[model samples]
Target chain A: MKVMMSLTVNGKLETIAVRPGATLLEVLREDLRLTGTKRGCDHGDCGACTVLVDGEPRLSCITLALQVRGRRVDTIEGLAREGYPHRLQEAFDREGAAQCGFCTPGVLLSAAALLAGNPHPTREEVRDGLAGNLCRCTGFQKIVDAVEAAARGEGDR
Target chain B: MDFLIEQPDTVEEAVRILAERPGAARAVWGGSDLVVEVRDGLSRPEVVVDLTRIRELVEVRETGDGGLSLGAGVPLEHLARRPELAERFGALAEALRAVGSVPLRFGSTLGGNLATASPAADSAPPLLVLEAEVEIAGPGGRRRPALADFFQGPRRTVLGPGEIITRILLPPPPPGARGTYLKFARRRALDLALVSVAALGWPDAEAASGVRFRLAAGAVAPTPLRLPAAEEILAAGRLDEETRTAVRRAVEAAVRPIDDVRAAATYRREMAGTLALRAVDRVLRTLEGGVA
Candidate 1:
């Protein structure tokens, strides 16, 4: 079935027709061409498809496209301001948070959500907050460091 | 079968839709497990009754009997954040804390967890220990069943075709009661349990009595099992070396585990014994006015 839904993506309002079975990841990557939200494990195990649904990190791959109606959706591409990197994105670049970059978008989104809620999270809190995101390449030490740096408002370009 | 997605604002409307749709529709709350199952092709429902829109099912009310009524749509994250739940229903709160990750906890509903009926589901053992009952609504009427009787087998429940779980009633523990939930998983976050145990009971200060315990083991059997024999042994006296050994033996006997990818049946049996002993020992220490 087709469902017409209004989604505010990256601060822009968009009205799109989505299939009931289509996932948010598919809509972001295919329909909207916001390919920054990578699709890893569509089953929600991997955090590669993470996006901010109402400023909270959510697994877009498992979330139905129709469920995001009247909600603000933010992908990794949406985090930047007019080609400028977000604080989290800048920290990732400076601290080498992304090794392979496959998990970068998801990690950035999760970290962004964490920092938005808690700007000064402890190391343990940052680790626990991003526990859902899995990074096989960087071993998560650098990611943890990046999140810590971002939370402290340090190491930003 | 027609694809019908009903967003009912009230319970009556939901029940009416269920009555009209019969077996074709299934109530979806949280959709953490159901959505995954549906996406994986395990369940193909003609109608998806989205219960998230129902505001009435999102409340956490305290009954006059000092018990808690968790609406069917209350997310696990919300349950974990309740200070009163942590202070009063320690086992339940601890179990809620250990379910999946923060994102899954935010999206997963307690009713959905119970309805999924996974033996390893974190909420079930604690609810079993709490002697929780579920209020289920169907076309005919509403019925309440003890949480234990709600499960028929793995991924199965006694809920009729058109029925939906509306609320979970968890009575407060008796005065002087202490409860703890111990989960042994492969990792700290987002891992399924190899074996888990929830112990809830009160201390018997008089005579040779120690803490009377109720032990519920998860992920080792077809359904989470209450180790009554182990509880009996604990109720006999303090869980000293001798009693701990007896309780461990009873727990080992109570569980019927299977060799899965998570762990071997023998390993699960051993872990169940260890967890039961540890949980009982920890609660006993608390009862003795020592911090655990």
Candidate 2:
């Protein structure tokens, strides 16, 4: 049975009706049309579906939409500010951090979560923090550089 | 994938719903494992009783006996934040820290790890060494099963259909005991354990009357298991080269491994001893915290 639930997604209030087993990834891409969050492996192994739920990076692929009923969920779509790119996004773009780009949104959000909690993270910390998201391109070094730059409050200037 | 998702606010209500539905109902927290199983058609429960909403299952309280009562729903991410808590249960912290990655850790619950009952579960070996007790709530009210008796097989546990784990009771490590969990994986991050070993030792006790050792192994057998034969030999007293080699051999012999996608059966058997020895040495060096 489909049920109605209210949730705060990317700063918007959404009262969406969804099947009981519908994942947060499904609702984000299909229902709300916010395709920023990509679905890689729906089994939670691939971090390509990563999103921020209550400020923590979580795999949306395995997260039931009903599970985040009244919680705040932030995705890659929420990272920009009034059409202005977020620093992490800017850093990734400037440093050529992304390659294939399928893993970019998830990696960016994971890094966003990292910077939000720890503004000046070490390189190793960045690697460990973003270990969930796999980037087959750029060899992960540039992604680490992008995250480190964002952590130091760089890329905007 | 169409099922009834009920978020019960209290333990009693959740238990009642589960009991009424029996095998048709299942409990979920974090849903990292269950949801995937549901999507893959590996498991089909009519009702998924969300345990996250139940307050009693999501807390981590220090026990009155200088131990810790880990709420089953406590996220693995919480372990990394509390360095103080990690220091106290070093092996468990190591195991959990090695669990998926940072993001998945935010969503993976300890209870889910145990209930999922994967043979390569990183968290189980440490709990085995810590002599943890599982607190379960079922139709009969509550029962605390020792960690040893908890596993029936892969993805199978002793938990009954209507029962949910409320908390896990872990008594503090021996006053001078050092704990260590060593995991070997094909990759460092987001991979299950190929072979892991968790061991605790009292150095002074070892020097005095052979050392008191509690050892457990993972991913090498049906479940994360405590090595009684190895423990008996190590407990017989002393960490001599002969004894160490004997312990390793005993562990290698004890495990019944199988050829899985992750590793070959022979390799798992070989690594089990190597990891076991490393875990023992690791605890010895815990008295020296990364200096070695």
Candidate 3:
């Protein structure tokens, strides 16, 4: 049986009918057409499906769609407001943090959550914050640099 | 992947659904473990009773006896950031941080960790040393059991039919005691521990041994178990180089590891003692705020 669940995604309220066992990643990518949330490893080991549920970075791949009912979910698409991109996203661009861009969305969201709580994180903190996100393209050096740059407000300029 | 999901607002209601369904139902909260199991065909439940909606299972309260009552549904990340738990129960705080990742920890619960009953559970070794108790709610009522006796084997626990772990009761740390948890994994983050050891100790000048130690290890046995042989050695006298070596050897001898995909039984046995020694050394460190 499919359950009708209403959730706030990227500040937009949406009600959709989903299977009882459908994953949030499935609903985000398949049902709502919100493909910004990647589906790397459906088993939750790969954090490519990371999203912010109530402002916490959670793996959408393993999260049940029904679990997020009535909760605020922020995806990578929400990182940019209108034409302006989030500082972390811009910093990634400036630092060449992304190559294939497969893991960029999840990494950006995880970085967003980390910076939201810690505006000025240390290099080690940035590494630890982004540890869950894996990027086979760039050996994480550029990604770490990008996160630190964003934390330093380098992207503002 | 095909199952009825029931969200109960209270523990009583949750237990009723579980009792009614019996073997057909399973309790789930922060499905980090259960979701993977279901997807991998390791677990199949016709109905999943989601307990995240239960208010009583998501709090951390002082037990009014200098102890702490940790609600089963409280996320591991939430507990890791708790100042009281961090200050009083250093080993537990360290162990919680050693779990999956920041986000994974946010979605994994203490109850879910214990319910899975994995021998490699990071939370078990520390809780065992702290003498934590698990409070189980069933159709009849609630019963608290020692955390030591909670596990029967890998993916097994003492929880009976229709029973759900409601909370974990943590006794207050002994006066002047310090503790530490050492987890040996291939990598730091997102890797299950190959061998883990937790130790809690305090100086006791009047006692026969002049010190008291509680030592336990994980991922080296069927269940997380105390290294009584090592604990007895430490309790015998002062912790000199000889005593440390004896403790290490005792731990190596006490553990009954198995050959698994993660590590060989021999490697696990050896590392378990090494980590145990490191944990003891860390717990006995004299520097203020040095112990984790």
lDDT of 1: 0.83
**What stretches of model 3 exceed 4 Å from their correct place?**
B287-292
Judged by DockQ relative to the true structure, which candidate is superior, 2 or 3? 2
Sort order, TM-score high to low? 3, 2, 1
**What is the lDDT, from 0 to 100, of the residue B46 in candidate 1?**
79
lDDT of 2 by residue, A1-92 (tens): 68999999989999989999888999999999999899897878779999999999999988888999999999988999999999999999
The DockQ-based CAPRI class assigned to model 2 is: high
Per-residue lDDT of model 1, residues B33-82, tens digit only: 76677877878877777787788789999997889999988878789889
User: lDDT of model 3 at residue B150?
Assistant: 95
Q: Tell me which residue pairs clash in candidate 2.
A: B206-B211, B210-B237, B210-B238
lDDT of each residue in A45-104, candidate 1, tens digit only: 777888988887788877777667788999888888878888888888998889889889
lDDT, candidate 3, B1-292, per-residue tens: 8888999899999999999988889888877888888999988999988888899999899988778999999999899989998788989999999999888988999999999999999999999999999999998799999999899998899999999999999998788788899999998999999999999988766656666789999999899998888988888877778887898899998899999788999999889888888887777784244422
- For model 2, the stretches where C-alpha displacement exceeds 4 angstroms are B204-210, B288-292
TM-score of 2: 0.96
- Tens-digit lDDT track of model 2 for B145-221: 99899998988999996888889889978877778888999898999898999998764433444457789999988
lDDT of 3 at B228: 84
lDDT pick, better of 1 and 2:
2
Question: Interface RMSD value for candidate 3, one decimal?
Answer: 0.8
